[model samples]
Target: MPSQPPIPPLLSPYLSTAPSASLTLLTSTLGATSNWLILRFICAALKNTSSEDGSTKGDNEATTVVLVSWLRDATFWKDGGRKLGINFQKVHIIDALTTGLGIGASSLADVETEILKAITTAKPTTRVEGEERVLLVLDGLDFLLAATSCSTLETLDLVGELREHVYTTLLTSAADLPLTQSPTTPLEISHTALIMTMVHQARLVMSAKSLDTGVARDVSGVLRICKGAGAGDKAQEGEGELEEREFLYFVGADGGVRVFERGA
Candidate 1:
């Protein structure tokens, strides 16, 4: 186990906080996966679930995570969670990769059904006092578009429907240059459209990609966090837009991730 906590102090504000009724978008690449960052979101949200004496907190401070993945298995996330001292078994999992959502018109519906089912039948530990806010994490949703023939709009509708059941929704997808900049094929077009639409709807957008200066012993990649189109709706009465921030992060051999501002 690593000595450091999963949620770094500098990254806590952005990783731990998820506004209610908002969407957060996480963009990653094959070279710089966001799995590490996603785990921090889980840790931070559930951090206040219990007090020092192991007593359950009220609904106001509790959070439950429901993870649905199309590109990875439950074990992959669970094992990672363990390294962070988190019990990922408590996280509701919808394994699209294993069960297969299938192709065509009904795929999106099936996706939505699975997610709602998970939330409906979650364990008691996940529901504090009465109702605990759920953070629905959808990993690799773009894979659904490429694997199935569902249009971007249909998949997006599924997103909206899922949001109605959870406090907030976090989505992850590949945003490589080809998919976002030079999309030409049908699959690419749909993937790009879906990502673009989500960006406009998301309150926070965090993008992870490899460093342009190449790999280094102390640096893993660069992470960019910015407010989205929906952010302005929640801004203070006289406040300006939220500032976009960037950081450099490194993942250690012991599965501990360190996220810090540039040059720190």
Candidate 2:
């Protein structure tokens, strides 16, 4: 378990300053999913614990979060969130995993409507008082391609529209060999299109997978962070491109993650 912050130092900047109108893609293989990392993001975002780098914030300072999980139920997140002291009241979770999102283009539109409603529930009336910073998180949205009849382009459009209402967007999906290597099947092809298109739109790309060199006693997996196609378009004044980097991470039984440079 980590003794420091839940958000490892290596990832803090990107999480805090991911530009608006951008996306952050968390790609995971079957052997190493990004659910654990997503939780850390949620923990930092909701309760947030601290921005002083050492101190904490009052309830009023919390960031509004809209979570849409297509692969896990409400119980799974609530239970895990409890471990991290997440304030569930501040988080709006849309659980599409338990039931179903239906099975066609119209169904996809209905799904989109539900997501928009959840995002704006707090201040549906206005942005006049001030702009609210709401983060939108979608876990396993790729599941839609396989479960429904929607095309990849249509699903991507849904993501684009959702980004309009939120402060930032982060999503997780499969990036296994078949999908990333050279997808050939219809589903794989669509899934690959979804991921690659996102890469072109995401400012930060965080991918997790087992060590290619095989098993290790201390390391469970590796993480790679790199700027995506979207990063270049949104570079702020004096802020240059982020250096590409990698780290080895170990997840403890207690569910804390420790990330560090290799050979550290």
- The TM-scores, one per candidate, come to 0.88, 0.90
| Model 2 regions lying over 4 Å from their true place | 1-4, 47-62, 102-106, 123-128, 237-241
lDDT string, candidate 2, 175-228, tens digits? 999776878888988998999999998888999999999988789899998888
Alpha carbon lDDT of each predicted model: 0.78, 0.78
In model 1, the worst 10-residue window by lDDT is 51-60
Clashing pairs in 2: none
TM-score of 1: 0.88
RMSD of each: 3.8, 2.6
